[model samples]
Target: MSPSLFTSLDVKSGGGTAVFSFLILLLLKMAFDTFGYKMGMNPWPGVFGWYCNPAYRLFDFLLGYTGFLVLEKTDLKVSSWKISVIQCVTLVFYFAACHLFDKQWVPAPFILLTLVLIFAFTLPGGIFNAIFGNRVLTHLGNISFELYIVHQVNINLMNHTLLKWTGNNHLLVFFMLLVISWLMAEFFSLNPIKRFVTKSIYKSKIFI
Candidate 1:
């Protein structure tokens, strides 16, 4: 989305408009993804994809817009240590549920539950920084965008190599996959694919 679009939407204004946009954009993105996945044929790239991608990104923008909305609506300092503690407790469940489930669809209440908890725990001065804050997590978070894209490729390579090294120790292979994926994520973050996005956004007069 363009900066102007966000400004025009006043997505931070925190009321009915924000709520409606947030919900609608997310639904649209999900619908689009499902449609794409079901098409079976290779998706048309280039101009066709360029035009179609914003339906997905709007959902991403609304996610951030939601945090600001929550702050405005609640008017409570999320920094309260008590709130952060509560948030972290819920975060433990959120992580557990994510790790445990196949996640075709998360239960609706849990969706609301986890978002609020994550907001409280992760905001500045929140307990997440105090308890889980460290170099490893910070670096992983920094490169998370690249990590999502690059980790699987690196993991596949490592899986084969580790098979030879450990004679098919799946436990050790999984551990090494995590470590090597992080390293590869770091590498890609430093030398990124952002050039294409940068050029496209600038030429198209779109926002970051």
Candidate 2:
């Protein structure tokens, strides 16, 4: 059983990436979080709700592209002050995400909250390179994508199945899921699998 694939269904102000000025982007995102859906769903089905899914994809794409830009910077310098501010905002977003919001990522608050945090930490001041550029973090980030794809469904299945037989143990369920997800991530990230994927994609005319 894969973790349920679902996005949050919630209210939104929209127009963060375009039309709005700089500050409004952040504001609108936070606003969505504050006003959007307030709960998580059990794994979603193919495709997601209308409002949030496209926004999520755009935000994520921009984040990765921004990281690439940061890494490629030739001579730009980032002030420590800006990094500090971003870090502070990132923490704020995290606080709101965990405490002020509900469990779902796609609905109102969680979607905006989580994405703002990503932007806060990864979007500016060359922090992307400074942090994820580290060898370990980079490797994890690579597999992290694949892990995100495979880990959740299986873990959720495990949790559901185990809860019935073993009753309920938070520690046991979380620990097992974490460990298993890591192993599965590692397996998908292994050299052989990586090469196979690369070659397959390379040979595919669809990519070309």
Q: State the C-alpha lDDT per candidate.
A: 0.58, 0.53
Alpha carbon lDDT at 128, candidate 2: 53
Candidate 1: segments with Cα more than 4 A from true spot: 1-21, 29-74, 78-80, 95-114, 124-126, 152-165, 191-193, 200-208
What is the per-residue lDDT of model 2 for residues 1-208, given as tens digits with 9 covering 90 to 100? 1111111101111322222332443455445444444332323333442232533444443334333333333343568677767778787767866775445453434444555555556645544557666888777877766666655466545777776666788778788788888888898788999788667864466544
For candidate 2, report its TM-score: 0.52
Per-residue lDDT of model 1, residues 111-130, tens digit only: 45556665666656666776
Off by over 4 Å in 2: 1-78, 103-105, 108-112, 123-136, 198-208
Q: Judging by lDDT against the true structure, name the best candidate.
A: 1
Question: For all candidates, what are the clash counts?
Answer: 0, 14
